[model samples]
Structure formats: structure tokens, C-alpha cells
Target: MKKTGLTIAAALAGALLGSPALAQKTVLTVGMQSTDAGVLDPHLNSGTPGKAMLQWMFNGLVRIKPGELSPEFMEPDLAESWTSSTDSKEWTFKLRQGVQCHHGYGEFTSEDAVYSLARAASKETSAFSSDYAAFDKVEAPDKYTVKITLKQAIPSLLGIVMNYHGGNMVCKKAAEELGKEGFAKKPVGTGPFMFQEYVPQQYAKLVANPNYFRGKPKLTEILYRFIPSDSSRDLAFQSGEIDMMLGRQEQAWVDRMNALPGVKVVAMGPAEMSMLHLNMSQPPLDNLKVRQAIAYAVDRNAIWQFRGKNISRPAVSVVPSGYLGTDEKAPLYPFDLAKSKALLAEAGFPNGVTIKAINTTLPSMLSFTEATQALLKRAGITLEIQPVEHATFHQQIRQDLSQVVHFQAARFPIADVYLSQFFHSRAIVKTPTAVTNFSHCKVADAEIDAARSETDKAKQLALWKTAQEKIIKEVCAIPVNEMMQLWAYKDSLDLGYDLKASLNLGPPVLETTRFTK
Candidate 1:
């Protein structure tokens, strides 16, 4: 009997050694580009770093197909199936059974879905409340069915419900028990990973969910570390301390990282547009000619050169290029220093104008603002930059403290989402229903509103074009350039799919992600 048992144990040990899964690394360490996570609440957390961590721990009713970015590739996630009314104002979703929420919050059902959507629609609870302004109500008629009624038709209901922004679902029981402040630190969701721990200014750790509806994640754990310095993150990757990292968006950095042995650098699309919002409510900038002069002083090509051409492109309109309804023919102020000087002088600033601006200390943003500062200086405009922590910068700008705000963002790839949030009068900063209108711009409000509910595709596009023309003519903001997402990872990491683009602003680590060796 003893001899037989010994032989069985030896065979089992041999099998384990020969198995590919046993040889693969189970822990994935990633280096992000922020000092820390701002919040974990799916509806309120808007920062890219926070979104990257949240993507692993949450799921929407539906999700954009893995390895795809467009809404056309969306597939059912928590919801098994869904249907919409003929007018596209009412959507009904049938939830999948046995979907478990993290931290033993119990199964996710229609109740959780209804509660999540209502919370997301509340201005007091959600930063993206304006996105759901058209939402009338959400109801759960059964344990596994949810219905959403909207006040007006949007460009796409799927775009709002997919796993981005306010669409990510939260655990109903967990949220009620933890409350708002508590939930922000320890969010509960139905994704493949469960929140394990978060150390401020350091890292947020997650462990795989064994009961994930799809399947168990091959990665047993994920460590999302915050290394704000480029050199530090690069060194960590080289030393194998991190499996992946957010790469710096510059040609030199990309070339250097690609040259490293066993390292692969990737540049993905769905670029984020960087625009300079000259506050129309603030003096100096409030003057129309002054704003146009600032626009003329900005050289989009020079900005494109600063960031590599491969990862950056000149933005032709208020709406980003490649997005729906982008009008490439929208007028642009040429890079004419003499015109800029003449305009500045005409605005009664012969000795150069001084403008105060608050800037984020994030490396990429600081670099861009510094470039803009140099450009404006040549046109006899002195841009006084007050650099602050990323979070503080966002707060101060929203409080209407900055004369000029250099904001970069990517929203749903539609004209209405971009125009309504940035150029509409209702979204003006410091207001009760503020979204992100830092410029206090209302030039295109009429056109933007008309395009939102327009059924005719041709008329919708025409309205959007008119909106872009009006916004550009008013010089509310200077559309600088679009920057694509970039990252560096180990060649051995499979990532589970081909990653062309991601709306989460980072690589999505799914159940199949595993190291080859």
C-alpha cells in the first residue's frame, strides 16, 4: 500500500511541473502615472488612473468587446439581453442570473441596477450627472429585469450604458451599508477582480474573483502601483518589478523603451484632445480679440512635434477628429505671431499681456502647458503658471480660479457629448449643474441642443458642423492636438487579446490575461 501511494504522489508532482498554467506568473504588477487614486466610486471617479483600477473591479450592463473600442463591438455583460423602444427613449435589460457582487454583497440583480443608475443620475452623488440629464427614470419591475426611460433620444443609448464613465454598476447592498465616503475607499462591483486593499499615494491591490460569471481570472492578483516619475517607472519595468506601465507620450521615450531587450511598446487610438480654454468670464481673456490673439499664437504643428507625430495629431475642430460629426473645414486661426502681436496691442496691452493660469503637475500636462507658455511668450503674452497637484488643480479650475484652463479629455465619440459638456452654457463651471465648461462658453448652445434630439442623420451632422463653426469663430477654446494612449509591457505578457484601443484609458486586464513564461 505504501509503495502504491508513493508512485501516485510522484506522478502528480510530475504532471504539475509539466502544466503550462503552473509555470505562469499569477501576479501582475502595473505602474500607473498618478500620485494616488482620487476615488474608487465608479460614478464619481473621473481621473484616468482611478478609471484604470476601477475597470478591473467593476462591470456595466454591457461592455465593449474585448480588444475593441467602438460601441458597435458592444456585448452583453451583466445583462443577458436588452431591447429598446422605437423612439430609442426607453431601454429594457434582462439581467443574467447568479451574477455575484464583491465582498459578499450578494448577487447582482435588477434592484442593484436600478439603484446604480439612479445614484449615477443624481448631481449630489455623481460627477457625471450631466451625462444622464436626459434620463427620466430607472425601474426594476422584476428580480432580473430593469427598464430605463429617457427624457430625450441620445446619439446612442449603448454608449451611455457600456463600461465607461457613469455606466459602471455598483453593489446595492454594499453601497447602502458603506455610505458614500466609505464606498469611495472600498467599492464593490461584479467584475473579475475584487478589491483587496488600497494604500493612499502608493498602490491599490486586487485579487481574482473565483466566482466571476465568465470564468476565473488566470491572474491571481494585480498590484496597481503609483509611480508618478517617468524614470522610476521605467527602471521598475526594466528590473522586472512591474510587468507593465503607462509609457510617456514622446517619440524619444517610445524609441528608448522599444530598444530595451524583451520590452514591447504600443501606441493605441481613440486619442484624447488637449484644448486651451480661455475663460470668457475672466478679464484679459474675456476680450474676444485677446482670445483670438492667443489662438493665433498657438502653433498646433509645434505642439504635434513636441509630442511625437506617431502618437499626436493636430485637432481640426472642437470635436476631435475621427469622432462622429467632426467638421474638418471648421476655420482655424493660423500661427501668425504678427497678427497675435497686433491683436494684443489693439487690446491695449502694448507691453505684452499677463494671464494667470492654474496647471496640473502631471508630467504630460505640465509639459504641454510649458510649451503653450513659451509660444504665448513669443507673442508678447506672459502666461503665469501656478503648478499644483493634479487633484488640487482640478478642484481649483472648477472653482473658477484659473484665467486659462488647459484641459485634455476624451468622451463618447459623438459631437453632442463633446459640445454639450464643453461649449453649452448649462455646463459652465461653478454652476449648480456644471460639467466641464471652463471657458464659460455658450456660443454654440442652440446648434448643440438642436443636434441632440435630431432624428435625421444629415440634419444632425449639419447642426454639429454649424456648432463647431460657431465655437471656432468665437475662439472659446484652442483645439491643440490629440494624444493617443501609450504603454510599455513585457513581451511575455499575452494580455488575452489584441489591444488596438480602449475607452478605459488603459489596457483591460481580463480573465485570460497571463504570462507565457
Candidate 2:
């Protein structure tokens, strides 16, 4: 049993629709498609984007500065600055004032922070509780002070705080007021917006929080419509039915939108890594030489060219370019079919190998995988692609049964968590561990442990570099490319995000405000 905090409390019921009170607010309609329905409980949601929405509906004690890169230790969202001991085992945070919860829970106190952190660490809670796995206990030293005791000296403790779903602060009174059942359906938190209602596979609505810590949001309300298909998404944009579309659509349609009287596109490509995950536990890939051969076979440049000029960048390592201090000079596994062939022969697969690749059906993503299929074929490898919907594709990865899978990993400021989650064998043991290392490469255990133990800042970076080298040397997976996400909306609509940091459109709907014409 994974001990994730408030997982049950976060379990959401079907969306509340069309109540007269819900209809009274101004609704700003947006578009989305169907996804694996997520529980509203903050800890239960999966990624950063989910955390972004939760940031609005519920606030944590500490939060990152809007539009800033990772240098964790949450600044005040509900709480002010925190001080940790030099040994890094103990931490004390002071709470902020005048904060109010959606259900009329009064000013926040040290007790709420203690309750929230303690709940997250409770083994009886849920799968997300392990996010607080390092914390031994959380205590309220005073009305405004929270003291936390840790299991070890982890340098990125604050980064852990900002770890999307881990730290959403809930009002204890609100839970008691609504009771378990009602609280699950209508949870309360301290944020800039409050959840209004959700119409499954249709739409979700939110109204501005009058008691928002900053000022109330300019947009009276936000309406998120679940319009899944790209064609339908394009149509919604064309007919003036939506203000923004999340993922990529037909390039022709995007061009049309740009040519339209009032539309613009913002293309952002961060150093985020998207790659093919090869399960080393499976045959064919069970041999390291075979994995290395696959890495050498693919022409990443050709993949980008397939979609036309500069849409995506070919990645040589698991660590994508542009993260803080990531040395680009680090060796890249370049495309060399000859070397790939040689490696395959050394592995005793001179005739090449036939393997199945689980790929997503998303149009933009399909292009890269198709190019992969073509390039691998030339290296004498036969890639039989298994095309499935994105949701199902992810579910399959979770099963750890696929020999090879094509997927995208969106992570942030620190490389540590990114390395730990994907490369660490203990993290992925597939038996209810703290994190899911989907690759199932149990062979990388020593390197993973070394990286985790390193706390000295400079030495940690060096250790991480060594770990990357080792993983590459052994051929963990063929890292493909970093996606360049593009977004287009009415020229007059200021989405209010710094393009450099706005990598994906999944969870964070931070500064989205509809302009008043």
C-alpha cells in the first residue's frame, strides 16, 4: 500500500453541474480532451500541470515565485520564509496572515501546516505520502511556526516542497465541516480561485477567489471545456468558441489561426527530455549492446526534419540541454548506423532484432515515433509499433511489461528528482515503492544510490554527471528529443506566462485572464 496523503479525501465525485449559484459567475471557456479522471485531492494528482490547477483551487504553505526557475524552499504562499538547520535535518517555517479558506475556514495557523505535512507523511494515507518520505515529523511550535524533522540531510528539501502534488495545504475545519464525503466532492483550500463545478468529459468551471492572497483574479471565472480531438479543438478556436488550445493541432490550421484577424502563436522548447524507454528486464533489450545499437541507429536530425525546420531538437543524453549548469560538452550518442550495426553483431544479433514500441496516437508525437521506425529499420532492426491512445499508453508503461515504449517526461528546475525518478532502480521496483522508475533497469542500483547520497552541492552535480555517463555506457534507453511546444491564441489575449518557462499546457493555468474588449 503506497502511503500518499489525503488520496481518499482527494478522490473526486462526478462534477457538480448547473446549480443556480454556480451559474451566477462569469465563465471563461477553455478546451481540453478526456484524460484519466484525477482525484481533486492534491497529493493524488500526477504531474506539475495537475499541481498548477490545484495551485489555484488550493494553496500550499509555501510556493515558488511565479515565473521563476527552481531554487526551492517555498516562498510564502500561505507561509512566510523558512529556516533550516545547518545540518539540514530540522526546518522551521513561519506562517503568513489574512489567508482564508474557501469553506470559511479562518486565518491559517501553524497547526494547518503541521496537519497537512503530517497527513502527507501518514502511512495509512495514500500513494502520494511518500513525497514526504524524508520527513520524520511536523510539529507546531507556535501559532505561526511549523517545525519539521527530516530523516537525512537532503539539499533539495525545498525542491521537494515545491514538488507539485506534495504540499497543498488543506483547511482542517473545512474537512470537518463538510465531513469526509462532502469534503472529497467539494474540498477547500487557500488559493486565488475556487472550484465551481465539473461536467465530466465536458467542462470544469472556477470562479476568482475574492480573498486571493494577491488581488482577486481579473477574469471573473474560467471554464475548461473537454474538447479532445484536434479537429474539434481547431474548430473551437476558429469559431471563437475557445480562447486557448493546449496541445498542437494541424500545422495548416495553426497557420490559418495565425493568418486570422487576431491570433498569434508562442512556440516554447525547454530542456525537458522526451525519449524511448527500453525496459532492460525484457528480452532483446535484456542485452546492453542491443540497447546501445538502438541508440546509435536513430538519426534525430532526420526526425526534426521530418516535421520540417526546427520544430524539435535531437537529444543525445537523457538530460536535455538548457537546465542550470548542464554542460552541453557532455558526450552525446550520435547517430552512426555502422557503430550500431557493430554493436548489434557483438551482441550476437547480427541479423538484427524485431521489437515492439508502444507509441502514442497524438499527431505531433506520432511524427517522431514514425521517424524512429524508419531510422531503426536501416540499422537492421524491425520496429513493430503499437499505436495506442495517450492515456492507455501511459497505463501500459506503468505495467512495466513493455519491451520498449516511446514517451515524454516533463520535469523542472532540479535535475536530481528527474534522475531519481527515472534512473533509480529502487524507485522503480514496481512493488509500491516511493516513485515509479518505469524503465525497470535494476542494474543501475549502485549509481542511483551514489547520486542520492551526495549532498555537497558541487559534488552532487559531479556525481549526477557520472551517473548519466554510466547509464549511457550501459545503454539504458535511446533518448530521442526535446519537444518544442507551440501555442496560438487571439493576439489580444495575454495568457500572462513567461514563454521560456511555459513548457507544457497540462496543469498550471496560473495567470490566464480573458481580456475585456
RMSD (CA, Å), each prediction: 3.4, 10.6
Candidate 2 residue-wise lDDT, 219-329, digit = tens:
777777766577788788878888766556334544666677777665554434567878788888888888889988978787655653544666756667665424355
> Which regions in candidate 1 have their CA more than 4 angstroms from the true location?
1-23
Q: Which candidate is the best by lDDT?
A: 1
* Model 1 agreement with the true structure over 117-149: per-residue lDDT tens digits: 888878888888888888888999999999999
Estimated TM-score per prediction?
A: 0.95, 0.83
Candidate 1, lDDT over the whole model: 0.90
Which number leads on TM-score? 1
Against the reference, the lDDT scores of all candidates come to 0.90, 0.65
